[model samples]
Target: MIPPDNQIYIIIFSTIFLGGLMSTFVVAMVFIHRQRQAQSRQKMDQMQVEFEKTLRHVENEIHQETLTQIGRDLHDNIGQLLSLTKLNLNSSKPEKHLEARECVNEAIKEVRALSKTLNLDWVESLSLDEYIAQQLQRIQATGFCETSLQSDRSFAELKKEEKLVLIRVVQECLNNAIKHAQPDRIAIRISKNGRARHIEIEDNGQGFDTSKQSNGSGMYNLSKRMETIGGKFSLSSAVGKGTLVNLELPFSV
Candidate 1:
């Protein structure tokens, strides 16, 4: 109903307004997308930092343990050889000489045992199950626990880093029970279900509330370690029901 000139002006204004709105929407979306990408990158960087820290800590501890083991082996095995040699020098009879030679052979046998016991190459190459069994055997020698292991041998499939973390977790937990809980009995059971491996360490000791009681760094470290590897950890305990630690690790599809 209006003049042709006015109608043209109205059309022009409408077109400009629509164009401005579309442009603004696109700019806003672009900004949001960039922000999201930056946040994701920051999260990834943080995780990497944490993982590296854990790896370094584990490596340091392993190095220290290896040194201690080697020292013990030398002192217990090779040191005895030196002692026997000195003892033989004190005796001059033919029978004494033969006995000294026999002692040397025994010492040589012990050196072989040392080589078998201190083999770190197996630690690096073995499966998780094998590593764990070896550890438990060492622990069991203390008459501390009725430990048992059942596995699909999938542990060897784990990366070296993963196996190290897992080993540390088990060692820490067992140590805590022995040092603090004074538990009379302990049991460890491991198994794999499909792509996930499960661990249950139960102790019949004086239990505490994991939420209220302060476990200091050990408990916190255990939880954080599991989380880093796409794993879950749970602790359940009562005043007298004892403590049970459960862990689960899931693999990427």
Candidate 2:
């Protein structure tokens, strides 16, 4: 056990063993790091898939809402008009006959226009800015308010999912402005802020305290939709001041 030659061999063997242990530990650390990275990438991919699926679900909901609106218009407004036309056609006077024909023609035109909206694919074909403008036009047509749109489409066209969620958010904002705010004028501005897209909808309507729900104007739903999309939504208003809605979304999902 006290041989000098053997002692030297023992020392050499210990050094080699220590070196191997260090190498194994280093390799283990690297493996752990790589495993964590893989898991993170998988999580992100899964989230993206889920986000897209949610967008499709929301799109279907919007389509259904549109269908309900069309149904009500047909049953209430168009149905009444058609009934009047029928009654006028049975009248003895020739003047009433001419008026009946005009009424029937008007109802036919409205039905044809509504038929176009019955198709779901029509929404996907429209650009984001175009869709927003159409919504604002509908509000203006109601004569409750005057609305304007200003958008910079040259910045970057949004992806389909991004546009879908954001459109609903914008719609909610517009409806809130009309119902709760009751503003005579509404201005919507859309532009880019660095990599984020900015949308501001300001109205001169009567303002209410944000702490209150404001008669359940669907503010919660708007905020939730924005959160789902990883976007920011903020509102500012007072008792006398008008309401301003600010929404910011990243360029890509």
Candidate 3:
């Protein structure tokens, strides 16, 4: 309204203030973006570390189990076969010699099977369903209980780490059934629906009361383990009817 020179100075000041505000806004946005990126990277690194730790734990467990199995096989299986072979050879009958040869052949076959199982790397080539089925078959072969498996799909889509975790879980369930439940029959079912993978293991055994079986935090540990993997674990049992374990795993898309 007054001097023209003053109006030009006013316009210059307004432009400077607007430019400073724009610059500050850009700097703030960049700082926030960088902060979020750092947080994401930290989270990813932590997950990787956890995964590696789990893998090592599983490997150690498997190694210990393998050693036990080898000892059992040597004493119960191969040793028995060799003893029978020696007895047959000592007999006067020619037919006994032939039986000795057959015994030796069976012993060799058993050793070969054990050798394959001794190799931890062999697990890498197996699917989760196949691994579970093998364990069920072994349990059934014991003649102490009848075992069955039902699977609608293959579980090759799961990561190796996931499969290892599941293997330990299944082993625990089987041991509990045999050691405590004394089940007459056991059933396992595996399936996938949408993004969920399901495993159901049921046994018709003399079940104990779930309310009072807190000797060593066994059940609690299993539940915590599943939660760590973003999975769900449940146990159902009665005094005499049976026990059922249901596990659900969510898969990444």
Candidate 4:
């Protein structure tokens, strides 16, 4: 009952319709791919913002903790010295009064020493050996754990950022070692191999599985900070073998 011309027209229309459908599907796939790419970019931007915010937050927290400890040391440790000085000043004998003056001078010296630590600019300028010595002295005073430092070359030639990162990394490692590992001895070593600067913090303490949540936020932050500065971070630890945190930073000069 169909005419030949009409049947030919039907076939032509069907072909055109299928071609349009395929074109539409191709366009839709392109749109989907672009959308996914945009989403991925947004996620990366958000993560960068969050990481920076977290770093600032943690830095402020560390500053506050340091201030609090300094306050306690001044009060409990130095305050007693002040009290003794006052007692000597109130003595009935002249010799005792002279002794009190000497005591006062000693206390003032101690206060000055404590005051220097309020600002870490000196640390930025100090050699790695000197910085480590100061850190070790402070750590020893806390009776938390013993620390040692060994270096093949002086850290005076290193960049300021490198020194700060190095100190922060070691501080985080030592903190974790004391708080989590409860270590008896912590050792820090630094050396240069060709153009690479190598640093290591090792502790003989109760270690945890590195594959798990062993390092915590402090260590994680340090790792991220190191990566930002073109450095490599690695950690090795076991239940009884203790922990070893290592960092390698490329040196141009």
* Candidate 2 residue lDDT tens string, 159-191: 666678887788778877877787989999988
**145-187: candidate 3 lDDT, tens digit per residue:** 9999899864668776777777787888888999999999999
Q: TM-score of predicted model 4?
A: 0.70
Give the per-residue Cα lDDT of candidate 4 at 244. 91
Report, for every candidate in turn, its global Cα lDDT versus the true structure: 0.78, 0.82, 0.86, 0.77
Estimate the Cα RMSD of every predicted model relative to the unseen true structure. Answer: 3.1, 3.3, 3.4, 5.5
Return the top candidate by lDDT. 3
Candidate 2 at 97: error in angstroms?
2.1
Backbone clashes per model, in order? 2, 0, 0, 0
The TM-score that candidate 3 achieves is 0.80
| Model 2 score (lDDT) | 0.82
lDDT of 1 at 235: 86
lDDT of 1 by residue, 71-185 (tens): 8768866788768866886887777777778878887887776665454565676677776677778767768766666665545467777777887787778778778677877
Q: Residue 52 error for model 1, in Å?
A: 2.3
TM-score of each: 0.82, 0.82, 0.80, 0.70
Model 3 stretches astray by more than 4 angstroms: 1-40, 154-156, 213-217, 227-229
Q: How many clashes show up in model 2?
A: 0
